[model samples]
Target: MELYKWSAQATGLGCYAYFCWCCFLGSLAEDINESKTSCCCISNILAVYRMKVRATLKIRGDSFSDACVVCWCPFCAGLQMRNELRNRGLA
Candidate 1:
């Protein structure tokens, strides 16, 4: 995958993101029996963040699709976003 090829070029952003995801998952496991809304809280936040990143980067995409992509594979989404920012000399 492109991610693997670009692993050597990856910035600290990806590692930070993966750490956050791991922490979120750990907390979620502890609250596995909690409400659905609680479980979705982090996903929703990340989705909104993704939308903002897309908008700020002037990337052409719909918010809903961005949310879907973030929710589906946040690790990849974060990596792509970081790469975009780096490419633009903003990261």
Candidate 2:
């Protein structure tokens, strides 16, 4: 009778250990899935932000070039020169 009781207790302990291991594995899988999802979200957001910054920089560069062209033109250069002279009280 004592031997049977010992065997039953050992079986119960084995089942409990297996159950705990399965729970730990399940939790680990969930954590990995969450990490992957978070990484994807962050990457997508960065991609969008990068595209917007590129577009804004392109527009700003184009505007600056246009202004430079206007300022360097003979017709517009005189106006700018006069404005500079006036600011220096030389006009």
Candidate 3:
């Protein structure tokens, strides 16, 4: 993929961009889940986030898995997400 090719060119930008993207995604996921869940005493929301990423990206998502993928191919990943959401009537 183009990501593999360009990743080497933008090492600095990739690190910065990828970090921001991962934080954004994690926070976004948390916010959505919090909105849907009214109960308290939940501290393991990130596990739910891992599952969401795994389901959406169709890949095994460890702690850094989503970050690596977004780092590899951010544009493609975003496009894929938009398309998936639109298809599911959530976009």
| Most lDDT-accurate candidate | 1
Candidate 1 regions off by >4 Å?
Answer: 1-41
**Worst-scoring 10-residue span by lDDT in model 2:** 1-10
Clashing pairs in 3: none
- Against the true structure, candidate 2 reaches a TM-score of 0.22
Error of 3 at 46 (Å): 16
Backbone clash pairs for candidate 1 read none
Please list the residue runs of candidate 3 whose C-alpha ends up more than 4 Å from where it truly belongs after superposition: 1-60
In angstroms, the error of model 2 at 43 is 54
TM-scores vs. true structure, each candidate: 0.56, 0.22, 0.34
Candidate 1 per-residue C-alpha lDDT over 1-91 given as tens digits, one digit per residue, 9 for 90 to 100? 1111222233456555576765543333332222334435666755665576666555677878888887788667656655655566665
Q: Give the candidates in order of lDDT, highest first.
A: 1, 3, 2
lDDT of 3 at 57: 46
- Quality of model 2 by C-alpha lDDT: 0.30
